[model samples]
Target: MAALYTTRSLSAYADLLDHAGILAARPEAAAEATTTISFATDDSREVQPGTLFVCKGAAFKREYLVNALAAGAVAYVSEVDYEIDEELGRHVPCLIVSDIRATLALIADALYDHPSGRVSVCAFTGTKGKTTSVYYLRSMLAEHAKEHGLPAPAFLTGVEYDDGVEQGESLLTTPESFVLERRIAHAAEAGCAHLVMEASSQAMKFKRTLGVEFAVGAFTNFGEDHISPIEHPTLEDYFESKLLLFENCHTAVVNLDTDVAERVLAVAQRAPLVERVLTYSLEREDADVTVQEFERTDGGIRALVRTPRFTRWLLVPSPAAFNLSNALGAITCAEALGMSANAIEFGLASARVPGRMELYPTESGRVLGVVDYAHNGMSLEALLNDLRAAYPDRELAVVFGATGGKGVDRRETMGEAAGKLADRIVITEDDPGPEDPAVICDAIAAAVSAQGHQAWQIVLDRSEAIETAVRETAGQAVIVVTGKGNDPFMLRHGVREPYEPDGDQLKRALAEWDAAN
Candidate 1:
């Protein structure tokens, strides 16, 4: 007898559905005929022959179906039936379901051979530390695997995606279910033991992470973010969406350091699928993972981790206390993953996240330039506080700008924080999309002046503002530039205009400041 193999056919896909309407030119195509789909995609251009194209999203149009069919899509999965032109009606087929988002996830899982079950999926979700915690887990897990002669862990984060073999730009925090499952399948085929990812609130709210089970789900602090007409309409919705990740994970590693910790834990405990909830804290003593002692060093911040199992020292190369909490969350997740303490300690010592608190020192040692991704009010306040704590003797000079068309209240909050905390302020452009940069700066400056800030400048050009901040601030001053972290361009009038990075501009500004002095 020949070897038997299992493959999902059109009939099997129909079996997974409780109710659906099938529209096809050929009735047999919609019936159980044993035809296997080779690929699936939501993008019309990505469709190929024998593809199951998913027509989704509230903004979807009929043109997408025509394009998908033109690109050789054999079938479509959508919430509603798409009308076809009389000439092409006979050749196109669509499977209409009530819930396209959930249907897409279930179908993608079946198509990808259920890869999430093959690897340890560890996810991090929160308002602030999701990106940083994702990076931390990848570094720690990779080091642990390398030391033990195992394959590196894979990650899908806001900054980038590491497939355990190579890194690539990440277009979204969490990709669509089809793309995400396919990437996980790639990792499983590459012999990866773990897949670490950031579960964005938007992804959770929209069911983009549906059908994927996580072994470990970590929460690293939460705040009010992504709240707008196009994003989450309110804070409660945002928080509830983040809690969705716990429902798909076996273990929950939560940070007990942020606001509303009790409420967050209460919600996570209600997740039916979560078996264990582990807590980590930088200040609270009762957490499962707690920091016993810490101090700022020339290289970074050194700390001691105390847990029920062991006490280990961690030398995290970032001075922010919030990042320490992020590291602790990663460490707790690593412990859940059975990584050794040595590997965790070593990884934390060497890991560095680009654009997150990137620091540059001047030759005179009196002026320090810092580039960070502190866009919102809460993050900005935390960053400025950390900088103030780090350099008690140095005056704090800040350059920042609010994003346009969204986060409308951030300008006032950020300006208030800077006015109270900063000695000198420079308001500049940060992705002022479709809004005048000077107008945004004026809002921030008005708030600063209201708070009695004496010295301020509004420079529309980001580079010029940075140079002015660097040149005007003299000895023992910390010149901090917030927002625009690692972004290659600025958004204006719905277009991404090419611009130099904050680090490059800072280097040039510092060089000029040096040359003039």
Candidate 2:
């Protein structure tokens, strides 16, 4: 069946669909006679049959029309006031909408059976930890409440999956808006009590997160990166764009650790619907929920969680104090939803976000290794500090650098961080998307040199960098691998290919080293 939209219903938003224009047909007949009472879309894959197909914008590819039509699209919506070729539209019906993108939204709103009113949704935005914090929130909610014994952690993510489950490879940080809502509706049908999602800076800036209200919103943290002509042009605009999430939500969950947290909180205050403000932090004593006693461990930090109702030792899995902030954000969210101490402890123990602060053990005496997604300076410094505290007497070997095609600002930032934090910094290629690996390492070296670091080397081969870092340390050392946590591919020239830079590979290498002993 085609995606259905009644002419009577669409007539109400005719001007909305066409950017101040009304729907019209070729015959110039009465709106009733010419208007598509209903037709299936042929060009857009997102548009179902009997739904309106947008035929505006020259950049619109022919493949979109062909695939959508083949899938049983029937009606067409266009701004060109022209017809698709006969082969493309022999059976497809057509009409003219004033604007194509707006029409797409209008039609999609009707097709999901109008699901917005039925769900309790939320959106999370930041440069890092969006996915991890969201997964933690969803999993916590799923375990606490048994709403009909069917309320499970349900939602879409920016990751890839092998079992069609939530945990898998991440192809994108945020998908298209059309697909995002559809996936949320599925979770709603599954009786999800909450929709926790990572709202990227790009998503909000492009208006991709519009047409929804987040019951809860958040800002994780920020740094000087993602500033580009294609991305955010400046740090202020980048921060301001992400601040929109706080406004769109009813209750805001904030991280006082964020440098821009105060400004973000101001945005939340402006929302007429915002009812409450919840906060979390590792350093701030005044936070609603805070870590009273923070102690670093071989794997991660063990923070004594303190809220008005409960105080318990919370153990984080990943080995970074940056994770301290991430875990604090999640705990604040869990508590605002009225989660118990038992539930909070349980969820914290069960919480394991892919590639955030993942750690693995090795056979060598005093050998600890961590793999993390800390591709920037703020995060790298935090992880290094935690490692230094955990093994104050030991050396810290660092491996990390910039991703290809990403801003070089991250390159300089990470370099500065490692120079200040690590005893031995071996700069390695991280994804190098389309840019040369040597180029990224040079940027890192320049930054490290400016800091007057003594022991820093540039290794374009990522695996070699990890291996060399591992080999350089003898008695006791912590090796930290930044920029690709649990990532299976190395993106070169915009295409992701198979590459594994595993910190746990040290486990096998350690065995070989121990054999010689």
Candidate 3:
């Protein structure tokens, strides 16, 4: 379906470019052309009659512009001029701008009636806990609103999007500026007063989140990830991109437990955009929000928190201790946004992140299944070590694989961690993208063997590997299925095929094992 738009003439829209701080230098004849833009899109396939096609990205080519025009685009927005057939150029106006990304953001904001101005936009950024924090803030806001008889908050994270009505899988951690503006617009129309989201390093690096001024910018711990030729080239570059969120936010909330907290705080404080800074921590007693005590209960983690406004015990219904820090960071943001203590407590108690430390137990007594999206080595090791400590009696077993073309270090580290902790292991295929799955599994298998662990098997098919892991240790150990959790598909050779969810696959495996036994 087409988005709502208000038509603006080429000359009129060009006139407003100065107000938007965009330099417009087009031929007078082209500017005077009677073209009207009723829609704006960055994708050529979405171009329609009177649409302004935004030619952005390093991959933009003349063919995209030609196709957009052929699809009835009245104008093209690009940072550089493109050659077109002389006759075709006369009908389609090419609007040259200094920065197409920033221009597209402004245009989308205008077309969407400036939705961000109407909504309280909150954003969380970090390497580890962006998605989890997004879920926490959304749930807290929902609880606060429900208590006051207000509308539910909207959300957009890497895992899913709640557009004030329905929830669906997300295309990106942070979508393109145009798509983001449209979703925020829909959120506003649905009476959502708050919009919580994740500000990914990639999105911030490309200025995809340029227009909105976040009401609260929250940060979790930063670590080494997303470094590649196409992504951030260095850890410093990645951290700098994550810092971009603070420059456009009104208030800042940071986790004091981060190793580089002082540096991050200094950066945020020095930025003229930040008016307030709040800190949360599990270790520091003097932070703005501090966890007084935390313990691993049978069901989950329970922590007592202290803040100037209130002191409360938060029951995080998850076994991961790292989640206590995530909750505190989110609770600080919620407090900064004026959420009551009751709402915070209720939200933390009930909010659950799908596929992050999601637990399942089989009908048989001794086989427990845990599914988590701990794809990288750091997270995998942390989860495994924590579970080992928490469940001393159960033998630790893991089913995991490394993603191809990325996380090259993860294969070795994951294998080493499993070898040191897990009693048994199963190495299998993950998203191998353009690389072969067998090769990816072989790397992990070699790593595990190098660590002098022999109780491991390599299964190229992930479902079979999961089933084998369950069947072999049905009544002896707790099996953790890692890498792919609730993800819907497996990426192989640039193609994604439908995949069985971890919970569903575990249930099927358990049934099969029970029947055979």
lDDT of each: 0.83, 0.68, 0.83
Please give each candidate's TM-score.
0.93, 0.85, 0.93
Kindly report which residue stretches of model 1 are placed more than 4 angstroms away from their true locations once superposed: 1-7, 19-30, 83-86, 89-91
For candidate 1, lDDT tens digit of each residue in 49-158? 77778888899998988888888877777777665647585645556677778877777777777888988999999877777888888889889889978888898987
Q: On a 0 to 100 scale, what is the lDDT of residue 83 in model 3? A: 55
Report lDDT (Cα) of residue 207, candidate 2: 54
1-517, model 2: which lDDT tens digit per residue?
Answer: 2222234433434544444344554322344243443543323645544455566455877667666666655445666544555776364445565545545544545445444445666667777777778767766666675433646655545654221123445566655545555555565565666666778877776655655567777778877778877688899988888887765577788888867878777877887778998888877889898988877665456889898788889887665666677777878877776777777776676776777666665654666777777777766777788778767988888888888776668878888888888889898788887788898899889999888898999888877787787777776777778788777788888788887646556555555555554
Error of 2 at 431 (Å): 1.6
Better of 2 and 3 by lDDT: 3
In model 1, the clashing pairs are none
- The alpha-carbon deviation from the true structure for residue 242 of candidate 3, after best TM-score superposition, in angstroms, is 1.0
lDDT of 3 by residue, 1-517 (tens): 3445667777665665657667567646555467778888888998888888888888888888888889988777777877574847464567678877788777877777678888999999988777778888888999999998988999998878987756799879898998898888878888898999999999888888888879899878887777777688888998999999987889999888888899899988887788999999989998999989888886789888998799877898888887888888889999999999999999878898888888776666566678888877667877888888777888888999988887677788788778888889999998889888888888888888887899999988889999888778735567899887789899888788899887789877866776676
Model 3 ranges off by over 4 Å: 1-6, 9-24, 29-35, 89-91, 474-476, 511-517
Segments in model 2 whose C-alpha atoms lie over 4 Å from true places: 1-48, 54-59, 66-71, 76-109, 114-116, 145-148, 160-168, 297-300
Model 2 lowest lDDT segment of ten: 1-10
How far is each candidate from the true structure, as Cα RMSD in Å? 3.3, 4.0, 2.4
